[model samples]
Target: MNEVQARQAIVDAGTVLYKQGYVVSNDGNISVRISPDTIVVTPTGVSKGDMNPDMMVVMNLDGNVISKGLRGPSSEVKMHLRVYRENPDVTAVVHAHPIYATSFAIAGVPLDKPILSEAMLQVGVVPVAHYAKPGTTDVPDSIAPFVKDYAAVMLSNHGVLTWGSDLEQALARMEVVENYAKVTLVVNQIGSERGLSQDQVDGLAGIRQNMGLSPIVMPKGNAEVINGTDVIPQGN
Candidate 1:
């Protein structure tokens, strides 16, 4: 996408994410890799929902400000840069405070168990990275280990970061993570999660490999888990 389109797309994504309740106030940022070295990112301290095209920022892979404006690069830019550095396939990164997913992250809970077919099939297990201070090396470093395995991550006590070859898939993964977290929360309350058997899980993995899919890890459990059975009854 050209610079005009890139900035416009960022503005549009901000509106969409905010509308989805995935971002609040100035709580999230999105970036699109325009090339191997150039990235188009959202500015810090601006309400993503209300962002205009002119508010966007452009930087190099090293986070150097290639262009400046009224807005500044996000403090979380390093974390976004780290993902691009590790995953050459990733072209877009959406980091937001998605409510359900962020709730789990803030609680220091890891979404490590698989209970959905599409989730395991699409993005895989959304690991919970260790808590790190926002806008610091620690945040990106905590996530670096999982960056190669998962397209999306639940940052402990922070928020969600989802990426893909493009923006749609990345944003879709974030939606999936939030949906998965919502279901998992309900199931955990009931005290049980009876997932699919080992053989079935392997089958899913086999299918993934056969399709030549990128390596995305499941939560070391079943593949196609039973629905209500996995939905543990509350207070059980």
Candidate 2:
């Protein structure tokens, strides 16, 4: 997309994230790759719900500011840059503190269960990266290991970060993460939960591969069942 379209997309994504309560009080950042070398990103200190397209900042792949209005790029641009560097297929990145998903992050949990087939097909395992100081180089370092293989990850004790082939796909992955967390929470409250069997999971993986989608390799083990309750494991 051109610079104008990229800025507009960021503005629209910000609105959706704010309206859906994925972020509050300037708590999230959005970025779209305009070219291999240029990116349009959300500015710092602005309420995402109240942003205009002009407020977006343009930067190089190295995170250098190329063009911006009076405002500057988000403090967390390094994380976005790291993602772009790690995965050439990623064209957009969305970071948000959606309630349910952030809850799992705070608890150091990984949304790795094969509980939802659609989620499995789309996002695979949402691992939790180790805790890192946000808005610093540490943030990118923490997420580096998972960036190449996973579409989304829980920022331990922080929030959710998702990347995709486009802005819409990235945002949709963020939504899926939150929805998965909500469903998992409800399932836990309702007592026992049974994940899809390994055979079923393998079948779904095969279907995903056939559809030209990435496959999620679930760890080899039975679902975590504790005293008739299903427990999702915490990330190391």
Candidate 3:
């Protein structure tokens, strides 16, 4: 997308994230790579819902400001830059604090179960990165291991981070993470959480590969058979 289009898209996406209750106050960040060397990002300290196209900041891949907006870039811009550095194909990055997904992050859990087909296709397993103080270089360092392999990662005690080839896809993946978290929460509350069988998960992986997606690294030994009766209730 051109610079004008990229700026407007960022505003639209920020509005969507706010309206969906994925972010509150000034709690999230969104960015789009407008060129190999530059990105358009949400300004810090503004409610995402209140953002306008003019509020978007432009910065280089090196995190240097190309043009200041109505305000400065988000403090978490380094994490976005890290994703771009790790994977050139990622043109957009979204970070948000959706309740369910953030709850999992706070609890140090990973959304790795292959229970929902759409979740599997859209996001696969969302692993948790090590806890790092928000807005620190540690945030980028924490996620470095998973950026190249996964579309999304849960920041410990923070929120979800998702990336894709474009803003729409990145935003969609964020929604999927929250939805999957909701389902996983309900399953745990119900005392029965049966995952898709190994064959079923493998089939979906095949479909993912056929669609030109990268391989999902499932947790070691997570492919074991899990019948409904075999699950132990995880009390909230």
Best by TM-score: 3
Collision pairs in model 3:
none
Candidate 1 local lDDT, 41-109, one digit each (tens): 998899888888887888999879988644778889898899999989988999999889999988888
Predicted model with the maximum lDDT:
3
RMSD (CA, Å), each prediction:
4.6, 6.3, 4.9
Off by over 4 Å in 3: 218-236
Q: Could you give candidate 3's per-residue lDDT for residues 155-176 as a string of tens digits?
A: 9999999999899999999999
For model 1, how big is the CA root-mean-square deviation?
A: 4.6
TM-scores of all predicted structures: 0.88, 0.90, 0.92
For candidate 2, lDDT tens digit of each residue in 1-236? 88899888888999999999999998999999989988999999999899998888889998789887648888888889999999888999999999999999999888877677777777878999999986778999998888888889999888999998899999999999899899888888889667776676676778878988665544332444323233656679
- Full candidate order by lDDT, most accurate first: 3, 2, 1
Off by over 4 Å in 2: 216-236
Candidate 1: regions farther than 4 A off = 222-236
What TM-score does candidate 3 reach?
A: 0.92
